[model samples]
Target: MSTILFHEIVFGPIHSRRLGVSLGMNLLPYDGKLCSFDCIYCECGFNKDFRTKTKLPDRENVRAALEDKLLSLRREGITPDVITFAGNGEPTMHPEFKGIIDDTIELRNRYFPDAKISVLTNGMHLNKPEVFEALQKIENPIVKLDSALDKTVRLLDRPNAPGYSVAKQVERYKRFKGDFILQTMFVRGRFEGKEIDNTTEEEISAWLELVRALNPREVMIYTIDRETPAKELEKVPVGDLQKIAARVEGLGIQTNVAG
Candidate 1:
């Protein structure tokens, strides 16, 4: 299984294809993956494959570590573009998520006032009041909506929630009121002897309808950039991605494609 795990509360000032030079903060366990959705394209691999036997870092610890890292970066004269909430799993799953966002905002205001705070989420917990509010507090609340159809979502994201449905999630996304960034992963492959592809005409048509309905501020369309847990998966070509972007752009919504 190809997987990448961050073993610290503050992991990187790594260059993100979409978010720029980002400093990552992980609220999940440092030793293993703990996400609500077991995405085949997840860099952290499947949840069961990397089950954590560790506790989540508390709010204070996350604040402290982030501060220390920011201080270190300041001394080096390296300013990150964004402080990203993403790591081993669904960050909103952390109990102190709302409080942590508060602390992070204060810290960012103190250390890097120009920097933005972003959260990369699967949107599984958007129905939770705390999670929804916390996401709103961030500059980029990038939520994943890989496919707009129930069956495709089930096959692609494999969400842990038994009653996960695209219809319910679309309504949940509407709560953002076009304030959030809609992220979708485009890929095609076979998993567990089942063939799958979200770049198809049918998939794209359905997804475009969702985009039209939700009317997000931005749409981020991309393909697998790293080794995925599912061996048969393949990346959508940059040309194909650009074509999709054109369609999204036609909808009058800004679209960012990371091939």
Candidate 2:
């Protein structure tokens, strides 16, 4: 029952454990959450609890607000390391996501040319040509792949699409051609009385196979850092995360651990 929501279209220059000084861009509604996957560990809380009247912010408003914030920061002699697309929910769900990305890049060039643009997505929309193309344009396109097993993925991510499968998602990620960063959240817990732990030997073995296949620029291994909707879930320790990273690094893929 712990729920947290970002209340503005443009919020935060918060220090990200992985991405560093990031200014967030929320394409979803400011008052509610809208996402393709209802993840068990989502800090924003369950989608059912966040129903609201507010609509997704349009491209124009997002551009204006972001520019204003960047200009103000510039005046104060501050520049974020990254302009991140993350907030209440899935950012690519926006109708004009590609165009908004275009606008963001333009603004970044005009203001903070050295800053990187990153999108923290679930990778469900990569099937769409536009979404895929827009993602390719960004500096850091971090996509999620919680587990390689279909059953474990369902238990962990709870993607809204019943037809969502790990094989299909892995294939979609393949389309990126090693240009994206793969972000996996490792957690152990029970949902509805069934025990769930994606950090097990079987799960990690299957997941490492997919990681090797993808050959991403980098692999980000992390655990829950805040209150989750599913209260039974537990964070993986830094030592364990380092072990996981070592295994991943053995595959010749660089890994970053956020524990």
Q: Any runs in candidate 2 off by more than 4 Å, and if so which?
A: none
> For every model shown, what is its TM-score relative to the native structure?
0.99, 0.98
* Residue-by-residue lDDT tens digits, candidate 1, 1-259: 6679999999889999999999999999989988889998899988888886898999889989999999999999999999999999999999999999999999999999999999999898988899899899889999999998888888889999999999999999999999999999999999999999999999999999999999999999999999999999999999999999999999999999999
* Each candidate's clash count: 0, 0
Clash pairs (backbone) in predicted model 1: none
Candidate 2 at residue 92, lDDT? 94
Q: lDDT tens string, model 2, 1-259? A: 7677888878889999999999999888878899999898999988888977797888899999999999999998988999999899999999899999999999999999999999999998888899999999999999999999988888888899978998999999998899899999999888889898988999899999999999998999999999999989999998988998999999999999999
List CA RMSD, all candidates: 0.7, 0.8
The TM-score of predicted model 1 comes to: 0.99
